[model samples]
Target: MFLRKSFTAALALPALASPALAELPHDWQLGMQPAATPVMVQIEDFHRLLLYIIIGICLFVLALLIWVMVRYNHRANPVPSRTHHNTLLEVAWTLIPVIILVLIAIPSFRLLYFEAAIPKPDVTVEAIGKQWFWTYAFPKDGNFQFDSYMLQDAAAAKAHEPRLLGVDNPLYVPVNKVVEVDTTGADVIHSWSVPAFGVKMDAVPGRINHTWFKATRLGTYYGQCSQLCGANHAYMPIEVKVVTQAEYDAWLAKAKKKYAANETPDALRVAAQ
Candidate 1:
């Protein structure tokens, strides 16, 4: 189909030098996107740890099921036990599940705390989630702000950008800098999330939620609104360009001029487009 060809052409395009335009997802990716931050790396480790535990538990249960069928099935044992009061077996089952829960909880709590504790941010960006778009403001960088709208499929095909993923503007941050994102919804609840950075924070009405990420590499990462907000929720994409400090400064200078700090949201949003 034409859509399939467009996708193939988009993926085949080579990457640019600027980190702002970096790696992208491919078809049928089975694992996480390459981790570009320490937080994401830790997330991957935690996931693998849980995966092993789950596999072990599943295998154990399968073995138990097989043992029960072989040892106590009607064919194997014609006489069913009249008295089925196995206190030891009941205790073992209860205790084993409790132990498993404890194992899962320890790391779960640790990861939750680590994600919640926003370290001193090198830069802070406020992401205002609207019905089907994102408005990003860099408070540390002269308060310049802009709206990021998804590129149309036609434009995306022409530019070789991923369909439904490319945006008119991208949130840019310096590489290896702790970038704190404050999220709030302009309309319905939305979630600002980037999987590679392992950052996902809800954008609730009248409430600012925070999350942080320090991009260890210079590249462009993509995400979409994790929350279902509107009819066009699928169109709300997030693109972040992680560049060097110098590149960030230069971009900021231009952005402050382009998207004036003094301008109203309506005016700035129009100008940015």
Candidate 2:
């Protein structure tokens, strides 16, 4: 009976793996995040073009070096070329690099504008970085706020997931909706970075930096502090949960009720709730 059950489980393994399981967190092995949104896709294409140009120039220079070593060696030419300069070669080298820079600059400028230019954001959230945790506030959504902290090792083990990277509270946003994030720091400098969304902005004390992204898929995306701010910098991770609009609204309503009571100390308001 045990053997038959094991065989059946093995047969069902393929079906059990869903789309979410196939798409893991972004890492260096894949170069960049999988291009899901339009901006990210364009950025990925621009990166590929830049990579090709760099590789081509490197290979051309390497080939020239190899040719010079073989054709102008002491045994091959006995006497070295005494020419001070080659006008054509110098001009070609300078002009080629200029053209390459132009090629790289055009797309780089476009990507910069795309990331910096603020669009009609569907929702806005404020992320404040503390010493070792993050506090998120949804000013437009009933003034809801929550504190997010990294999951402990024992908790992560029970959940069968990695520790530190997982958090207790995750920022929830609606899929395909533009989310504007205003980040600031309470104590020191921090960075909010999520590779899947291709959004990273610094959180400075007493000042706010803005960045935006529209999630193309509904899933939980994880990120960590890109800057070294404090002793527990590695412990501060960011988790974003993207859901449908209906689900987001439901969660918002619940969060508002839960946090609203604690936000105000008015006895009347607390009693009414």
Candidate 3:
């Protein structure tokens, strides 16, 4: 009765805490996403820089449009300046865009290389994208493979977890470890996207695309398929559980024993049980 009351109180608190605000399950907000990982922080910085540039450009363009409409109107200036085109203005317009492209290209290429470049990874995992599910193999640990499916609505509701974003089996990794991931598909194409990790790559059939990330914090990060592959594409969600090194090692050991087949019957039953 106490546990039930506690759970109900917890659920009620979120609603009353901030009635006007849209309550996000995690600490990250809608306007501001999580920068829990190192790569994600870099991506966030890049995003802010790009946003400033875009806003500046938009305001400038709007001002220019208004000036043209008001100052160049027939009532304002009956006699137009006898000028087809100014060479300086033409050159300025052409070269300014080129300079802007160069400015944008430097960081864009750097980010691409950062995402594509794989460093000396502390751990490696092979992620296989199946129809409406994801299968993960911790090849470096013990070749222990498992499938991750979306938690049913009833299950999520019982657990008080996020709807449509929670999973039965979440991918676990140690914080501050460079995790190398190789992605492939069993059927059609699917893209694994985690905005908080700054990682997104297409899972192509018969081929593997590689990416890596080093999580800087311990938290439950959520993501989903960025590409629409099939009818149940929205059903597949990605949950990453980052833990301490000691906890990760313990989990790996238990996972290896849990998936092993050559153990004693009682032990096997206990592990499975």
Best by lDDT: 1
Please give the CA lDDT of all the candidate structures: 0.85, 0.80, 0.79
For residues 190-222, could you state the per-residue lDDT of candidate 2 as single tens digits? 999887777889988767788998988877777
lDDT of 3: 0.79
Give all candidate RMSDs, comma-separated. Answer: 7.0, 5.5, 7.3
Ranking, lDDT, top scorer first: 1, 2, 3
The order of the candidates by TM-score, greatest first, is: 2, 1, 3
Q: Model 2: clashing residue pairs?
A: none
True lDDT of residue 127, candidate 1: 91
Per-residue error (Å), model 3, residue 183: 0.6
List, residue by residue over 1-273, the lDDT tens digit for candidate 1. Answer: 999998876766543322334556778989888888888888998999989999999999999999998999999999988987899999999999899899889988888898889899999888999989999887656866789999999997776667888898888899989998888888899999998999889998777788899999887889999999989999999999899999998988898998994443553334323
Among these predictions, the greatest TM-score belongs to: 2
Candidate 1 is scored at a TM of: 0.86
lDDT of 2 at 130: 85
